[model samples]
Target: MKAISLFSGGGGMDFAARSLGIDVLFANDVIPETELTFASSFPETDFHLEDIRQISKFPSVDLVTGGYPCQSFSLGGNRNPANDPRTFLFKEFARVVDTVKPKYFVAENVSGLKSIQDGNWLKLQLDTYNEIAGVGYNIATAVVNARDYGVPQRRKRVIIVGVRKDLGVYYHFPKPTHAKPDIAAKKGLLPYASHGEAIRHLPLDVPGEYYERPHDPEGNFSWYYMSRNRKASWLEPSYTIVANFRHTTLHPASPTMKLLWSNLADGWKQKWEFSSEYEHLLHDPTLPVLEKPRRLSWREAALIQTFPEGYEPAGKLEKKFEQIGNAVPPMLMRAILQQIVSGEGLLQFPSEHEQYLTVGKQLSLLSEEQDIEPIES
Candidate 1:
């Protein structure tokens, strides 16, 4: 079966689909900076760099998958649906899907979408899909964590998969190959990939750049992102990687550090002085300052997101980070698509591209964490 991807960000989902040997007829993304990255890996693909809304026609393909913009509905952004024009871009997705009439369609968004406005917006989006063209689609939506599917990061996303009603098929999500929770952890049921486990194989002396920034150099940085949660340990799976690399997860080599900010009558006083370029931070008198020697290099960040080794990205430093941060984490996409495509009898992977698919499939493929070696580049 062939595929046509929309709002494709760095082609993560595209790579996953191709891993299963699903040939992508065409693909489109809004960011021009990502074309080189996608093309570098998939030279045969017809890359379209433009807004999805401008797309009047799309190649007819069996599957359509994309992570429509979720900044507005994301918990990190203003939850106002009226104010965020990007959130409305789903309508364009609907337009293409309805026009092309693919057998299946998949859309990914931030899980916080379910909580915004008491889930009204999420319900509306699904309901709208039901009447796209004639009998529409039977859409199934679920919140999935990437760590549960062999990725090192604990990124949670709301995946919405729609099987065209005319196809008379239903989508079955893949079961978690990786485990979480204390019981599962102790049972040794494919424990979530640890920070160290995610990048232990790579040597610190690699020829590529190794950033030396000071921040969450010990654990995943979620403790500081949203209000700290119980699972806020740095040793656990990493936090959701956003496009902003500067504020991303610090390398695990550094010990855990804290930034103390307290409530004041006016509002709050921040311990990590924002104006100081994060060079000087204030911590509790009891907690000593941890001196971090390096930030997570781009390659390390990509590895944590389960991007295959030797999958050198394109563009400048910030653009490279944007492509990695915005991607769907191909490991997670493969988990879901593997199950879905298996049902469609699309299990045979093409020989030529099999190497690309196998990039990160070693221990991660089995959901078992293990030490890796320096990439054979």
Candidate 2:
């Protein structure tokens, strides 16, 4: 099927849909940096580097997908402030959808969209879609965590799927493949993937520090893992991969690692500087400085979001993170696309090998005994 991606930041949604054999006919974004990356990655696809509101043209396709800007709707933002202009971009998405009339459409946003002032803002947004599309759209909403789709990240986002009313069927969200603490780890199942599992094999190319120097020997693991900290829970998936790298530190031995600060008394700063060894890791001048390199590399962040390795992003490093951080996890997108294509849900399973899930559980149990608090959301 053919597809068009709007607000296509670094084309994460595009990559996922394309990986599932969907033909991405058109990709649009207003940011030049993102457009460059999208163009480089999708050389064959038509890319529009203009505002969706100003675009006078659009392609008819089987699907229209986008994760519209959520700053206004995000909990970290203005708490779904109706006044924020970014929130209105959803209307632009709807406008194009109405004109092009794709068979299916998917919109993604932060989970906070559901809880803003008790969902009053979300209701208005949905009502607007209903009004614009005029009822042929069978809309369903679900909060999806990337880890459920084999992403090593625990990132959660709200996903909305709409099928043309004429299709005569409702779309179901993809099922979770990984086991949670509340659920038993099913063997012979797809073992829950981990942060280490996802990026372990990929070559590490640190920011502004390429592998070209004589002394810069290539290694099998990231410097982040050099401290040999115990792995956290593998079965439950990882926490979100935000733009800030300092938020990436959850390793027990890495005192420079900053856990997410939830409460005022969490002592985040102290924890970030508990040991001289870890403090040095945080101050490593080689690390990227946008948010903090303590989190993850841009490439690592892309992997957590399920972008395949060797995918070259366009623009500067910080721009790359901006595009990557805003992207949809491609693995989750793949599941969504599969459901759309097959008209049925895919089956998930536990693996007979069981080692992958078991090791993760064991490590998580050990960390809990040590009282290692997980990074905050």
Candidate 3:
């Protein structure tokens, strides 16, 4: 089936759908840099640089996907999505859904949205979708962790899926594929993948200091790790790639020694040391010391987000991070796409009883692994 992506930051949703063999006929985003990246990577798809509000007509497609701006709804940010003008951007999404009337729609945002003003605000958000789409739309929401789907980072997002009501079948959320900390320890199972596993093998140079002209630019490695220490491993997943670039330093003792040294001399040492000590105090775990505020080359950041290593982003440095940080991780999106295309019906709205059952199962599993009682909130 075909899809159209709105608020398409660097085309994460588009990438996921395409990987699942779904065609993205059109995409729209306001950022010029993102539009450029989308154009370069998705040459076959039409990309428009326009405000979502200005798009009077949305293209007809089987699906619509987007992650509206969440700055207003994010926990770390001001919890003012309802009153912030940016939150109304969802209305534009709804407008497109109403105009295009796609078979399905997926909206993603930060999890803080669920607890906005103790759920009252969330209700209004849902009500808007229901009203705009009408009763035939079967809508469901879930708080999904990317780590549960094999992503190294512990990023949690709220996913809202809406299927045309006439389909009759409810959708269920995708099952978790990675083991939690307790499960890994108790069962002697492999822990969830770490950032190192994702991108360690690439040849490293100075962090964020690109070779003026690569000897084998096209044939050379696309990205490399940039950690605080030289001994840090790359075989695991990565830390969250936050919008604040200063926090992107790799672990100390990362295998990428050259990059670590470069970061240390360039003023990442103090921040890195502080973070390392803080983490040690909290967890008492053995970890290498590293420098902090080490910049991740744009290419590396894209890879951590699961974009192909060579996928060149459009625009300036700041613009690139904005797009990347705002994107849905493609790996997570891929799992969602698999559920939809396989007709797994794995996106169902659970009744209270079903939710209770699921929670019970989860708690039991956690208790078994942690050797402690599970406390329900």
Candidate 4:
């Protein structure tokens, strides 16, 4: 199989495609840093370093894969899907698929799209893809957690797959290969990967390995960041890696933050700070700072996202963080592709498509302890 990757950041999907013996003929991204990183790693691909809207030509291929920008529909953002221009980027994805007429195309975004406007936005997006030129497509969507696919982070995203109607492909999202400890034992699945497993091998003090540099302790940790616990222990998966390295999850060695008070008048608000036991150490000149609430380095973030240790994204610190945070975990994409190539998903008609959308309990962004209701398709 072959593919053209759009909105390709550091070629995460391209990396997975190559691993599965799928040839990636063309890749596109507007960010120069991403192009530099992508070019270094994938010298064989024809990469376009320009806006997606300006690019008009593409090679014919079997697949089109992209994870369009998610801020427009992200829970952490304004959540204004009704008027946000970014939310309509999927139409550009559909346009490319229509032009290439690929047998398969997969689009991914933050799972928040399912809840925006009560899933109507998702429904409309689905209809747009299904109406593509010729015989149209058989569309299926699912919300999957990165932890379930062997990534050491708890990132969740919605995946939409379209199979051309003429192909009569029997498609379903892949079954998870990993699960929580208790759930894995009962289901005979692998235990979830932990943050330690991803970054423990990297020597923190190594001078030459530039990627090992940690976030400055003096960097701002906004009130919003401290609103909940950001520390993931050695045995747990790291929190979602955002584009801003400063706001990334705290190192596993750092103490969990403590919420001291809360107010729910205008909106849910809370006051949090370093744990009582650890607070004294910050001001004590006699004691050595115990990691001092440092954010994960770009390399550590990359590892938790399941990128190869040797795969260094191009450019400065902030750019690297942006690429790594925005990337779709390669392992997650590999699982999806494996299922598609193996033809192992159960067969079903369009009416039963909703059953294939695997919705599960998700960790709320507001508080690590809160369990928000998942939107059903």
lDDT of 4 at 75: 85
Residues 100-185 of candidate 3: C-alpha lDDT, one tens digit per residue:
88878898988777666665555565676777645446666667777667776657787777777777655566666666566757
Rank the candidate models, highest lDDT first. 4, 1, 3, 2
Instruction: Please name the candidate that would achieve the greatest lDDT relative to the true structure.
Output: 4
**Compared to the true structure, candidate 1 yields what TM-score?**
0.77
**124-171, model 1: which lDDT tens digit per residue?**
677667768776776655667788777888788877777776666667
Error of 4 at 34 (Å): 1.3
Which portions of model 1 miss their true places by more than 4 Å? 185-188, 205-235, 258-267, 270-291, 344-377
Query: RMSD per prediction, one decimal?
Result: 10.8, 10.9, 8.8, 6.3
The Cα local distance difference test for each model comes to 0.67, 0.64, 0.65, 0.75
Tens digit per residue, CA lDDT, model 4, 5-70: 999997778888999999999999889998889778999999999888888899999999999988
Clash numbers, per candidate = 7, 13, 33, 0
Give the per-residue lDDT digits (tens) of candidate 2, residues 101-137: 8888889988777667766665666666666545467
Worst 10 residues of 1 by lDDT: 367-376
Cα lDDT of candidate 2 equals 0.64
Please report how far candidate 1 places residue 276 from its true position, in Å: 22
| Top candidate by TM-score | 4
